[model samples]
Target: MTDKTIRHIGAPASGRSTRERLNPARLLSWVSGYETLVLLGVLIVVFTLTSDRFLTADNLQNVALVQAVTATMTLAVLMPLIIGEFDLSVGYLIGFLVMLEAVVAQHTSNPGIIIAAGPVVGLLVGLVNGLLTVYFKISSFIATLGVGILLSGATQGISNGKVIFENIPSSVTTLASEDFLGLSLAVWLTLLLAVVLFYVLEHTPFGRFWYAIGGSERVAYLAGVRTNRMRMTAFAAAGLIVGFAANFALAQAGSANPGYGPELLLPAYAAAFLGVATYRPGYYNVLGALVAIILLAIGFNGLSLLGVPFWVQPIFNGSVLIIAVLVARQETRQVRTG
Candidate 1:
């Protein structure tokens, strides 16, 4: 039979195939392509219906404010991930920078100086991490973990296990509390950074190089990408972004605690992994990360309103991470098999 004749086999005698029109598997495949977005919509609807305050403009603005730090850190995390590396130090690094900012504020009242110091320290730490991984040939996972431990120790030593509640300038607090156009400045800053990252990752050659390296270092190197420099740069960029995030954190909390940074690690990573299931599906992107942060913030906020215990947040976050990773992997498998 001709190809055209075979194609006609599924058609009904009246020129319509009922089976094809009602195929549940095909419907499922189409829906699965936008699973994250669908889930977000469903969550929003569920929360809105179950709680009186969930869909309020005020609550949403609050969610954006609360998630700003996580969104920023997720962006920072994405850089290293793009180059096939992990900066495990990001959690403690935040604590170390916050402590440094507080200590600096105590000695000096200059907001610019206080803010600049955090990024410098972060940059230095990131460079050190990159050097260890790239030049010394150490694994990024191990190197970053060791660096994180050292940072945690240094933070404790410097703070002496005391949270720095004093010497935080009014300007520092204002940075977090100040509102513009019905939202905090921190939220605007996060949005701005997200735009910048979107442009770089989606437009620039530098971003493409990182993806290439992540795909295959040897092949990327053969294709004339600077594998070592790009990897190191990715680490350095992550540090710089983390430093920026630390400032937002300080502004929000109005103080520094030695233990605060490590706690952020799980949530930040969870958001990052969950982000893979958003927007671009198989690849990590800043917009997706921001969406994931918002989704998480909403979920936690709803739970809090429902009187769920504080410990449940971490459990929820961990579970989301595992599910997101599995979904991302399945999407990847489908892409390969399809």
Candidate 2:
């Protein structure tokens, strides 16, 4: 093999006609990398054309507000995924924390303390999950699933198997109502989290270590990457993010429900997996996850505007998740076989 790398191995000479330059493999690769992005554009165009209200500023802001929590959870889950592990309890963690947040608010009107409760607990849960998976050698699926079930039961107990709407202070309840430039605080907070994570993952050695660890634990360990510690840190970071998500959820709804957070599990995971199809393609990424969240949110908003049945959401999310996995697999293959 030559030392030089071909720009596009499948492409013919540049001197060839423009038609020859438009090779199928190149096109497929491009499309695969930006699958969600392309779909997002298509959806926007379709919905804008079909529904008179779809492209309005008010409706778009509403979409942003509605998707803020899902975006946060999706971002939270991306940490464990980047390190080549799963945190099935991601959903339940949010559920438990939101209930906990409500309880905190109920007992104390201090906005600082009330908001702090969620992230603190979230960090602890992540630590416990890390202990089970990284230290005890338990499979992540089993460990996080166990934690998730425990959280589910705890949420039920905390809220008495129902949503908590009473004793929530006016300050706590109106947190999400604060807006800047027509967008809610929830939207701003989620975007802030995304930017921070993006920089950490893309511009720092810490991020490189994570990617190395994800590539191969054994290899990263042999290279003195402290695979176990980093893996635990990943889970912990994920928990911290979920904690913020809980706060956002509580702020937006002005009430805490036992099962509300858990319901977003499918869409959250869908965004996380679909993230692999864009931005940094062939691997899990923060930016990709954010984009995926917007795509899912817009898709849902468009469908709802078209008067689709409530049942269509699950099917739509499930199909996107499956497609995301397939696209990710193919992109990984391309990266490897190249």
Q: What Cα-based lDDT does every candidate model obtain?
A: 0.83, 0.85
Q: Which candidate leads the pack in TM-score?
A: 2
Task: Name the TM-score of candidate 1.
Answer: 0.90
Cα RMSDs of all predictions? 5.7, 3.3
Clashes of each: 0, 0
Per-residue lDDT of 240-281 in model 2, one digit per residue for the tens?
999999888898888888877677776787788888877666
After TM-score superposition, the amount by which residue 221's alpha carbon in candidate 2 deviates from its true location, in angstroms, is: 0.3
lDDT of 1 by residue, 1-338 (tens): 00110111133346647886567765555655356667778888988988898899998887777777888889999999877889899999999999999989889999999989888999999999999999999999999999999999999998899989898888887878999998888888888998998888877898888888877899999999889999999999999999999999999999999888887787787788888876666677776787788778878888887778889977877776677768767876776575
In model 2, residue pairs whose N, Cα or C atoms come closer than 3 Å (at least 3 residues apart or on different chains), thus clashing, are: none
Off by over 4 Å in 2: 1-14, 29-32
Residue 142 lDDT in model 1? Answer: 97
